[model samples]
Target: MSALNTSVLRPAGFILMGFPGIEHLQHWLSIPFTVLYITALVGNSTIILVVKFEQHLHTPMYVFLSMLAFVDIGLCTAVLPKILEILWLNSKDISFEGCFIQMFFIYMFVTLESSILVMMAYDRYVAICNPLRYTTILSKTLVCKAFVAFFIRDLVLTGLIPTLASRLPYCSSVCISHCYCDHMAVAKLACTNIIMNNYYGLFVALSILGVDAIFVGFSYIMIFRAVLKLGSKGARLKALNTCGSHLFVIMYFYIISLFNYLVYRFGKDVPVHVHVVFGVLYLLIPPVLNPMVYAVRTKEIRHAFLRHFLPRKIDSDLSHR
Candidate 1:
């Protein structure tokens, strides 16, 4: 065998896939990203704390909501700090390994979040369609089993891409055209012909986003039908109210996801703002928005938020004084 090379594949120049001139505008981003980062951390984290802290939230809906919070936290951590550093410090530098790791967690957390939404849809369907059998249908045992299965499936699907990615020979243009290590963007720069890789990535992407979209669609159909059967305009509105929050959050993510892939992946000459802003929003916005939607739109989570965290806030101020 030939001698093994030991050089680390850190890119030489500004090979970032984001908006350029961060050096000039980077200062402006600090305040906004800092505020966003902190808000997302506190909000998403509170969702988790509330669900776990309150006894009333020991049901399937809250369990998956907690899982959604967990996913939000993970995705936020995966993308935000590096982005903040790049923006604030004028450093668009990320090593290949760091990029790879970030890509893995981003994909994994995204998959988990999507799966949790699927679970939530199912939970909503049962609650609305089979009220008497909700608990029996979604028991602790069944939920645990489903969680385990979802976790494993997400882990496997996302992990496969990174494994394949690590082995590919990448060109020196380490400029990933997005803020994070979007698999498609990275794949585009690989020196090797990536038919199989593209196929696999497409399969996995469609599987998570596509399949979940279908599930959400079908569930809503059944839900709407059931609501029609009830024959109460008020009940129909309430049923729709229960769904609006998730619908907005889901539509936003998928639309951005489709836009990212379509504009960058298919169409060349992607704008810099699309890379920096859209990529950041792709991961962080949902976390920030999802919790707000849950708190403001969904009553139970709002009450749980009040019960678990509100008094702590009151006590903290009292203690500080």
Candidate 2:
């Protein structure tokens, strides 16, 4: 039936195979996926709300954190709900235009999140290496300008991906093997030669992840040097401690991302479901863990979270008692 329908230059829609080999287990999969989605939603929302309300947390670091949380929420919302619908409702069809829209938001938020992490690393570097001038260097104007610049960069670079992919005539099977509208997965569905799309997509991924990773690593190296030069062991410990959450989040983001990228592109002998599961995880895990890591590790965020969620009397009692 699908082969007969392939005569059309562009199909009406595409079927998102939630997990290609384990279709029978989609119901079971949705259980954990729902939990993750809800966790990400609540966790990132709490970060944004806490940072917005806590006047003392309005520094460049926390401001960047809130930006990250916002990106996380956007990234999750872009595809997770569609995934849930596919898994639970068995509604796997996505219109041609809708798929590109999902691709756009996913890439946009992912890029923004990467750039924000770089900014956050720079924020940490300024705070630790040049404390006296931290405020002056990372001024509101500077931060705003940096964010705007990267945001525009994300828009230009990521927008081209979907735009170019869309131009390709998807006359082949309109079944996407993965959960959501992954750029490469969708590009593979096109009947035309997709080498350009493949190369450009790989280029974009490397540019965002590779360059950002290098800058972040360099920033930390400089930070470590500055920390070692501090007068006391306690000061050095405290300085490194401040970066613990950010470092964890960065490692978590990059390691999983790099592994998933390699497995998807190179691990041809790997199972399709494994690729799909990792792809889902690639988007899901960060949003779920980022706020939890920060909440557990950052004192200011923890306190503000308690003050907001716990009742006044209970918060006071917990703090005192």
Candidate 3:
């Protein structure tokens, strides 16, 4: 028995069927996807560079934004290049190892983003709820510690999902209906029952996302209470303004993620193309939008971007005009 090959059979690889129903439109679809990918890359890279070089913006909030931009870059880069390859070059084969690697990074970046958002909420809570101690509380050392803690938490939690999925005996078809190695999409191909994997994925997802949502919502509630207690209307508005962008980002992210989760779980009748497109967007949209949201809503980022990127002559011309 020891000499009888005991290892389970694994698929040679997975074929990423990108937008299965719309094969004719894939060439056209690649145009928009390419634009979004490029935009996400440039926008996030700009945010990171601006924050790093601009000393005036070296506060806790900007630091967290920079971290978010970095993660956003990773999140999109993990999936888009392969997606573009499938769309543009008709290359769709992802090695088993490559698929697992992509799955791990996708989960890691997502969970890490959740933790960072919580940290951002906490940062706002401190800024609004306890202004005097903001500097002392979120000091350089503590920020470093928070990043490490978030990274470790996500590493352990997100790492388990792909690890569990990878262990399944995938002795069946290897065609993944979606563009990337989505957790459930891959799980469904296992010849064995995936009830535990299904529930575990849900549990871990809810634990990270659900818990993050509740905490962020609570922090905002506390922030509002503090804002109301302020003596000046200007102070109240300023506090609310500070939180508006972060809150919008949270709502946008959660809404799409929760919808996608629900559809995957319950929307059996939902068209595969619809689900796939949303899945792609769920991962892609945030990276493309986060920097735009911050730049549009936050004056410091806007001014800094103009200062660094806009031509001096044009800036002076605009000012003069």
Tens digits of per-residue lDDT, candidate 1, 1-321, equal: 122232323233225544553546667877887888888899888888888888888788888888888889888989888777766765677777777788899889888888888888899899889999999999999999998998899999989997888777664566776666777777777766877777887788788888887898788788777877877889878877767657878888877865654565465676566555776777888988888877567778776676565878757767999
User: In angstroms, how far off is 166's CA in candidate 2?
Assistant: 0.7
Displacement of the residue 59 alpha carbon in candidate 2, Å: 1.4
Candidate numbers sorted by TM-score from highest down? 2, 3, 1
Q: How many residue pairs clash in each candidate?
A: 3, 0, 0
- Poorest 10 consecutive residues by lDDT, candidate 3: 1-10
> Candidate 2 residues 215-312, lDDT tens each?
99899889888988999999889877766666877877877676666675678899988888888887899999888876657889988888888768
Higher-ranked by TM-score: 1 or 2? 2
As for lDDT, the candidate ahead, 1 or 2, is 2
Error of 2 at 43 (Å): 1.1
In model 1, which regions exceed 4 Å deviation?
Answer: 1-17, 21-24, 269-272, 311-321
Candidate 3, residue 54: CA error in Å? 1.3
Each model's TM-score?
A: 0.87, 0.92, 0.91
Q: What's the CA RMSD for each of the models?
A: 4.1, 2.9, 2.6
How well does candidate 2 score on lDDT at residue 190? 85
Model 2 lowest lDDT segment of ten: 1-10
Tell me the lDDT of model 3 at 39. Answer: 97
